[model samples]
Target: MNEAIALMKRHRSIRRYKSEAIPLEHVRLAVEAGQAASTSSAIQSYCVIHVTDGLKRKKLAELTGPQEQVRRAGAFFVVCGDTRRHRLLCAREGRAYEARMEAFLLAVIDATLFAQNMALALESQGYGVCYIGGLRSQLFEVERVLTPPEGVYPLFGMCAGVADESPMERPRLGAEAVLFENKYPDDESMLGMIEAYDERYARYIERREGAGRGWSGSMTKKFAEARRVDVGEYYRSKGADFS
Candidate 1:
């Protein structure tokens, strides 16, 4: 495989970061590379917020699952699914538009593309990166801090910096379990593949965490819990009109 393929294969989320700071110029270039990411219909319905304040980072860490990575990373960014610019353009041109589910999905797709591109770009620059999904865990606090408008929502955030350590890549399910041909195989066939995968994942987790709960056990526990997140409602309240 080529360099890009090799790099992607070795991808790992890094939470432990060194204290060294990344130059602002490089940060801007990485963001520009993110901007180059494929946008849904070229709408570019996304935005990024770079936060450098120490106190604010601490506050974000507290609100976002108290993740130390947010506070400790050399550079932090919040990627937002935005429709504000589109709304403004529509209003200026006397065009009719409503923030529906489709619009929301497009915004999310655009933002996700940008974030992934940014991650790759930063990694290519020799920076370790991690995406903080915890931003969604506490919506109100994140909204308060970001102060986004009605046509914008914080999708996720990223932390990038020099790495303190190198970690092993996590294992993934085999092609048989995930990648189906034109037609999906029978349930039993898939289950058989997953059974094999479970054994591999169990060993992986055991080696990594010293406790091997395996795939089914870990996923069962994760899904068994009531994760009552009002994501759709929150977005609706913030100008994501599905009607």
Candidate 2:
């Protein structure tokens, strides 16, 4: 494999980290790399907040599953989807900023792409990184803490620092299950692939976590109930339209 592909394959979601601080210059370079990521219609609808306040970080950690990484990591960032600039542009022309689901989707996709690029850049610098999706646990509290305008939505948090642990790479489904020739495979074929994956996943979990759980069992229980049902309402409050 090429150097880039090898680097990509070595990705691990690092949680524990050493206390060494990442230089501010490195952080800026990472952001620059993130800005280089592709955007839809050239609408750079994203903003990143570097949270350095000790008190704010403590509160955010509490809100987001008390994930201590937020408070203790060498650096922490909150990636947001922003449409405020577009709204102001419409106002400049005395036109209404009509909210559409498509626009909202574009902002979300753009922000996600930017974040992944930023994470990859940080990882390339030898800093371990972890994405904190638990930030969605309390979107309202996050808004109160960040105090972003109506058009900016905090999507997730990220922590980057020197690695303190080396974790085994998690197993994923094989190409035969995920890739297809022309048409989607039948349910029977998909189930067979998933069953095979479950066996491997169970073995991995037993080795790493001493748990016998498999992907299907965990996913089935997780989706058995509607989760984060209020996320849509939170977006609506930010003037995002679902219709």
Top model by lDDT, which number?
A: 2
Worst ten in a row by lDDT for model 1: 226-235
Residue-by-residue lDDT tens digits, candidate 1, 120-158: 999999999999988888887777887889899888889
Weakest 10 consecutive residues, lDDT, candidate 2?
A: 227-236
What would the per-residue lDDT of candidate 2 be over residues 33-69, giving only the tens digit for each residue?
9999999989999999999898999999999999998
Clashes (N, CA, C under 3 Å) per candidate: 0, 0
Score residue 213 of candidate 2 by CA lDDT.
96
Cα distance off (Å), candidate 2, residue 62: 0.7
Top TM-score prediction, candidate number: 2
Alpha-carbon runs more than 4 Å astray in model 1: none
